[model samples]
Target: MVWRPTLPTKDNNVRLEVRKTYKLYIGGAFPRSESGRSYVVNDAKGKFLANASQASRKDARDAVVAARKAFGGWSGKTAYNRGQVLYRIAEVMEGRHEQFTLEVAASEGLSASKARAVVDASIDRWVWYAGWADKLAQVVGSSNPVAGPYFDFSLPEATGVVAVLAPQDSSLLGLTSVIAPAIVSGNTVVAVSSYERPLPAVTLGEMMATSDLPGGVVNLLTGSASEIGPWLASHLDVNAIDLCGISDAEEARELEALAAENLKRVRRPAAEDWSESPGMSRLTQYLELKTVWHPIGV
Candidate 1:
């Protein structure tokens, strides 16, 4: 006797895990690449993961526009208010702990415990930078005694739109370390995520969107930085470029030259461990010293 195969019904319940499709985070929205192209992501062992939007020159341009638009309101916000928003981001990120741990483990070929440590470090990094929001100026600025009867003060100010090439090695921790410093000091960012492992960055962007942070304050793109970095380095509206993602001396030098056209502040990549305490250097890197003079005999 032949037996017939039957499809599963309510009597035989089955569930399927839903997979996620990653997209670029621009202006607080997840948008497909303007070029309408995408590349597949894989685990450390070459297993399929998902497709990530492959950002192009046009996408870079759009991110710059978004960053520029956000500069005014973000920079204008009180330092205390900015600190609150940053703390909110840490809260949201904490709620997504399991998700980040799983992704980081797969992308970086680490065990669960190791990945959790990275995730924890990233969240704490945000908190550390948040505390500096209200105190950065005090630590970085000073009053000077001028020869004349005038008071002179030098204060640290946001340098406007900054483009960051996030470190590719430590996808989560390094990315957090690079991003928090720039935005914590009131500058908005357009960052390039890791070319091979970008899922964690997209998840961070999601947390930022819901954390009461304003749109475009931190735009993230997932693609080849080599393809997009030149446009960002040369962008006239961008006031600075963080070259932490670049390791090659020749490439870093070339981007530095491009940034010189507009005299953009360029921070080259340093060989350091992201898991260690970052100190105050990152806070000072993207800041500009603005000196003001006031009459003493008023």
Candidate 2:
């Protein structure tokens, strides 16, 4: 049974519970969105225990500002330092199993056990991505050759601000897939969550906010995907778009076209295979082909 600390009576229960409200976590601090908006998060029983931000375009801009502010610090850190920070996130996720299972159950409308599974899987996903931070450079990257090389090489660099359309289903894993690739390769992302599955996204945000991830590395926004998906596609600030969860070919095409305006890296949706495939492939989708050149001297 979920623990209820002392069954609040008809008296102070009202006062004590009133002090609690789920708030959006931004920039490593839990603060009400500057827009000051909230929407209800309903449980499977259709009861509301908390509210989530109706994150606005203003919120998006604020997130971009935060990401920009944090970028130098995060991206400047040594790759191993970045790896350690990313791994710390998984450590934080480890200690919050009960809370994750309960909140995920409420948000996704799944059975408690199933919610537990998703939460556990999500934590493992972070560990998977964490392990990739320092290693992706070595694995997906390679030295370049020239006619007379003095030593030339290129490494994958961040694609700048990326916009993510989180999965329509499998909320947690889907978001993890999208965000992991972007951040692991050094890109920053502003994610539009699955409208129905936004709860876990914010929960993941809560973990990141507290887990030593520089703020804005992964900004989570929950809203009309159809509405914002295209907007983000054409957003001047966005350098790449990952349309992984968009199953509709027409919509995907439309979004891809929008991304073309700025030549943003576009990753089209792929066939779903839960069996086994290297998830590191997410890093390759947005990786840029930068080439360094040097002339051989006599």
Candidate 3:
């Protein structure tokens, strides 16, 4: 007798999953690339996952405009208030813990438990940066001694519209490490997510939208770093750039040359252990020191 495949039954059913269209996060809203372009994103196993917006040079320019517009307000907020907002972001991320773990696992090809650990560490890293928002002034700023009857002081201030390149390998954790430090110090940012593993960064943009953070304080673009990096590095309005995600040495050198035209603060890429302690370097890199002199009586 020949065996045949079983027929569908009422108790068994197949449902189609709703796939998400990953778009660019700009000015606290999700918008498709103005270029009307998109690229296919794949899972670690090389299976089709979804489509991500391929941001263009125009998108990079728009992101810079948004960051510049939001700088004054975000930097003006009290340090304690900024700390509270950062902490709130951690709370929201905790609520979406499972989703982040799933995305990280697919993006990095890690086991479920390891992804969970990374997610947990990302949340903790946010909290750690939150705690520093209020304390950074005390730690980095100082009262200077002068021979005259005047008081001299040096204080750290936000560097204004910073552009960041999120790390390629450690998507979530490295992304968190770079972003938290910059924003905790009140600098607005336009960040380019990893080209290969961008899902976690898109998820992060969602959390930022729900949290107490203001629009345009952090703009995320999902596309090629090579395409976006040069524009941001050379943009006249941009104040600084973190080149942590640029893997090509030649490309990095070229970008640095462009940044020099505007005298932009360039943070060169280096081998980083994302899981280890992130000291004050990232926080201080995007900050400017302001010195003041005042009469002792005044």
- Top model by lDDT, which number? 3
Write down the lDDT that model 1 would get: 0.93
Pairs with steric clashes in candidate 2? none
Which of the two, 1 or 2, has more TM-score? 1
Listed per model in order, the count of residue pairs whose N, CA or C atoms clash below 3 Å is 0, 0, 0
lDDT of 3 by residue, 194-284 (tens): 9999999999999899999999999999999999999999999999999999988999999999999989999999999999999989999
Q: What is the TM-score of each candidate against the true structure?
A: 0.95, 0.85, 0.95
Location of the lowest summed lDDT over 10 successive residues in candidate 1 = 7-16
The regions of model 2 sitting more than 4 angstroms off are 1-15, 18-20, 31-36, 44-49, 245-247, 271-278, 295-297
Sort by TM-score, best first.
Answer: 3, 1, 2
Candidate 2 minimal-lDDT segment of 10 residues: 14-23
TM-score of candidate 2 relative to the true fold: 0.85
lDDT of every model, 2 decimals: 0.93, 0.73, 0.95
Each model's RMSD to truth, in Å? 3.3, 5.0, 4.8
Per-residue accuracy of model 2 over 1-298 as CA lDDT, tens digit each: 7877666678657444453455555556666656787777666677865667676666666666666666667667777777787778778877877877776777677898888877777777777777788887788677876667467877877667778887777677667767876787677777878766577777788888788788778788765567668877887778888887687999999999999999998888777653243466677776776767756674
